[model samples]
Target: MKYIWFLPLSLLMLASCDDHLLGTTESAPCVRQPPLTYENFGLPMIEKNCAGCHSSLHAGIDRSNAPVGVDFDTWDGILLWADRIHVRTYEDLTMPPTGGLTEVELDDFDEWMRCEVFPNAERF
Candidate 1:
């Protein structure tokens, strides 16, 4: 009878001790995501932020129709002025000039510029 009780107590103690032996802790490592690409970053940001004003046939910056005069429609035009756009909209806090995206969205934009856009531009 007493032996049976000792078995359960020993098992519990062993289980608890295993955690200490393995050096288990309550904390976990944090992970962050990488940048976005043209297919993901450009289209979504343009659609949500720029399209309202700079859409096709609007204010001489038609984006939906074709690449024309700093067009945000194509990759070439976007890469052409990524820096200006980033500086003004993100860095300088100018674009969407009114209500704008949140901090995470801005960070995403910056990451995209740093990783995806600049690297490809340098290749060319």
Candidate 2:
């Protein structure tokens, strides 16, 4: 059938593992010796860097124009928006509009997201 070519083309596309289309680096496997978690590494980072604008407690003008339901005050919230967080904070490099995270923090964040948050299921 004429459509037979479509199958191979589709397989080729899938084989490319283009994660950028999803705005996530989920294709990258966790290489960190010890994975980072929300409690120890992520919470402090979010509190210091994101909560001022993205916390649930912050409302109205205090939210600093951050969209509602994007709060990073809780682990669940972080999980829900994990991809967006990765794209904005890490890939796009457009987050924390004023004060940016240090290089060390960015590295840790990249690790946490790739390993703990949006881990590549293929690795398992």
- Model number with the top lDDT: 2
The Cα local distance difference test for each model comes to 0.61, 0.78
Q: Model 1 off-target regions past 4 Å?
A: 1-35, 55-68
Q: Write the per-residue lDDT of candidate 2 for residues 5-120, one digit (tens) a residue.
A: 99999999888974533534444456655667877898999999899999999999999899988899987788778777888898778898785788778878887876777653
> Which candidate leads the pack in TM-score?
2
Candidate 2, residue 66: the lDDT equals: 96
Estimate candidate 2's RMSD in Å: 4.7
Those runs of model 2 whose alpha carbons end farther than 4 Å from true positions after fitting are 1-4, 7-34, 120-124
